[model samples]
Target: MDLNDLHGIGAGWWSRILAGFHRDAGLEPTLLELGLILAVALAVSVPRASWRYFGLFVTMVHELGHAFAALTTGRLVKGIHLRFDQSGAMMSRGSGRAGAAWTGFWGYPVPAVVGCILVLAAFSGWSSLALSVSALLLLATLLFIRNAQGAVIAVGLALASSLLVWFAPAALLGHLTLALGIGLLVGSVRDWLNLLGVHTRRRHQLANSDAHILARRTGVPSALWLAGFAAVITACWVHAGMAVAAVAGFPA
Candidate 1:
């Protein structure tokens, strides 16, 4: 094998990836453009065909949120299990019920938090940096993947992210990031709706839900936990909306 075939990424590509770290021109979306982006985001997130693949990325992010939160509390993370069906679990050893509650809380809200960060980065001329950093972080999660499917998803996502960063021009990266950020935000809402359906329609699946788990552990009703997740996700949407609103004048 040619030495240039290093992990499918040549040595020169390192500079291309590293070079994205610097800020370039920021693109502020017009009201009409913001509406269009939202529609495109919804197209991917709301459609089942697109969601079947894209939702896996959201699930990966969800599980990583649990692991990151556990680490934040000094918990020892064991491993992560992810499936093609978009289900996942993160194992960790930790003390303190509060810590568990806190960790549990993050799984639902983190995608929205990340979405807001991406949107803000797009508006601030850091879209390339955001994409590169995020892809590297996704690659880092490979260390914690315990199952075959999880390994595949992690590697697949990292490669996709890397390719996007490597090939997308700086001028267009902001629009792409904005669309991605919006997709994540929309996906978060869709997942939340599915969880809500689990509680309201499919009570049998409560065992697999974060809110129910929180309620069982904290003695806080599941409704309240769900509310907490909604609150955070809503706040992220509001913040991102305001950022768009600042630049977007009256819609034509």
Candidate 2:
């Protein structure tokens, strides 16, 4: 079936799913949207090939989080590397202890924060704004994508987001924002869970994990960093859920 026909089939269900996301004229996600967000997150978390490909978007956001944190903390970011395997990394140089620590700490939590914000925007009827911000972030990250695979992915996403921000219809844009948010949430949760596994075992490839870097820089244990990362992600989940519920006219 064509795009329109596909959209038509799910239109009724999408309407119900997003029923309470909008109220009045403001742009905060309501209870219905929040529930939808979690539901979508869970769906994307399933181990399927389609979901796995979508996970690439999540990995990009996760790596860009590190890149942005590095730049924000006065570090010079050399480049970002996204691999075919869906693992990614940010290369940067910073001598400041705080900068190093902050960059490393941000890697795990940033995706959830970004996703939550986008979900809020989507419910707020700010699809244009949501897409614009996302587009800008991806474009800015393009300057730092060093590897060929990363460059192609970054450029492709940047172009797609830009086009959507400028041309997509309101309803389609909203769905896209929701999808992005859901993917990010799923990816963040999955990544943290993987780290938790490594933490429990007390062994992981140090070079491949953020917690190890944080531990090395801050003289803290990797397990502690992993715990803190988990806590931050949990906080994001709670915040998004409560905000959605409160706005949906549910009693907070």
Candidate 3:
């Protein structure tokens, strides 16, 4: 056959092959993607050597929680700092007593609530919605990120999430959504447990903890504040489970 005839034959064959692959690819998550989701879930299930990364993620969420609370309650957010020592801080101004109390109150439980929402959205097949919301929150938090490291981390996360929302395939997006949702939920729970452990075992080191700050402002005991945080997180976990179960059966 001539070169033109050969070229047409090759192009037509390639197009048919691509169409076949697309037809079989489907939109649902595949077995390999599900395995990946399982792997991510297990990676963040508990506090261990790999927990440093989880801690950083939780710290970002925690600080962003405070920042959002500050802004929502009529406070002027100045900046946020995230450290490698599994700690973070948010600076704000113009917040009166009520605003301060709220900002302090939200720092602990907000991560759990956010995790719950993510889990619900992921399980309900709202992958795009989940990624979009996550990217927006990270972008909003980016405005208050003060330090170089914090800015890098926030910008990186926001960009990755934006790319996923805009370009990831449906199955890949769903898989990643579920993985991230599970990781956040597990990390938040582990953080809460760790907070309780620290507050109980190292009572003298409670000076900078959110519970201590809340206690100082509200004239309540730090232990009570810690207990309240635990209660709210527990409730959120339960409700998150229920929501996920309603959509995709109980999570194994």
Candidate 4:
């Protein structure tokens, strides 16, 4: 079967699954043009076994986002990572309530943004460059950062998010924004509590402890950063939408 045929079958299966979920939730899930995009991405990504390294790159992007956020807030980055079993790069910021909050709040959005970029690149026919850049980013992140779980989670999340965007651009993008925000909020709260010595159990430990380094001057407000992140995500959605439109020969 042609790639399109294969993708159509996959899309049909996914549609049924989504329809079931939507019915259960008393909501509607729009049919998206993600199948073709996914087919293209898969066709391009699967040929080379080395493409798996892109996973590492996704991890790096996640860590780099945390690192950048911490740095912007005047926090020191103790370490970072591009590779690990369960996490991504870890930043070690100094001790402070604001610093802790910022670190936690900045975690998930980075990977989400990276995933958006990857989707854009893939759809725009920059697959090779995307894969190469992703691999390099992952290698660098692993070399520099320390949070294994964050790196791993970030990569996994990015890939999953990209797939969602590819398959269901409209619904998935909004959902991703909300989900990412919730995750960041939860992470921040957990980190703040951990910093206060509220949770000492190893099982309850935050993932990016290494990413939080020495504390620095409190510069930008976490709220502002979050707002900016939201904007970036919106832009990403627009880009993805346009790409899909172009692929369909619709006016962008």
Candidate that would win on TM-score:
1
Candidate whose lDDT is highest: 1
Q: Residue 211 error for model 2, in Å?
A: 0.6
| Cα lDDT for residue 140, candidate 1 | 88
Q: Which 10 consecutive positions of candidate 2 have the poorest summed lDDT? A: 16-25
C-alpha local distance difference test of each model:
0.88, 0.74, 0.73, 0.46
Candidate 4 residues 1-252, lDDT tens each? Answer: 999999997686445334322211111213343443344444333333433443343345455777777777788878864444324545566767776666655654555555555445444344334433443444444445345565564556455533543455433333333323223322332223333342245434423333222122345543454455555555655665565456556775
> Any idea what lDDT model 4 has?
0.46
lDDT of 1 by residue, 61-144 (tens): 888899999999999999999999999999999899989998899998888988899899999999889988887888888999
TM-score per candidate: 0.94, 0.79, 0.78, 0.41
Quote model 1's TM-score.
0.94
Instruction: List residue ranges in candidate 2 displaced over 4 A.
Output: 1-42, 201-204
TM-score, candidate 3, is: 0.78
What's the lDDT for candidate 1? 0.88
Task: List where candidate 1 sits over 4 angstroms from the true fold.
Answer: 7-10
Q: Write the per-residue lDDT of candidate 3 for residues 1-252, one digit (tens) a residue.
A: 999999997575444323322221212445565567768876875647777666677788888888888989889889999877778889989747888988888877877877777666666556566666676677787878889888877887776666665556665665676677667777777777777877878777787788878888889888888888888888887886676555444465
Order of models, best lDDT first: 1, 2, 3, 4
Q: lDDT of candidate 3?
A: 0.73
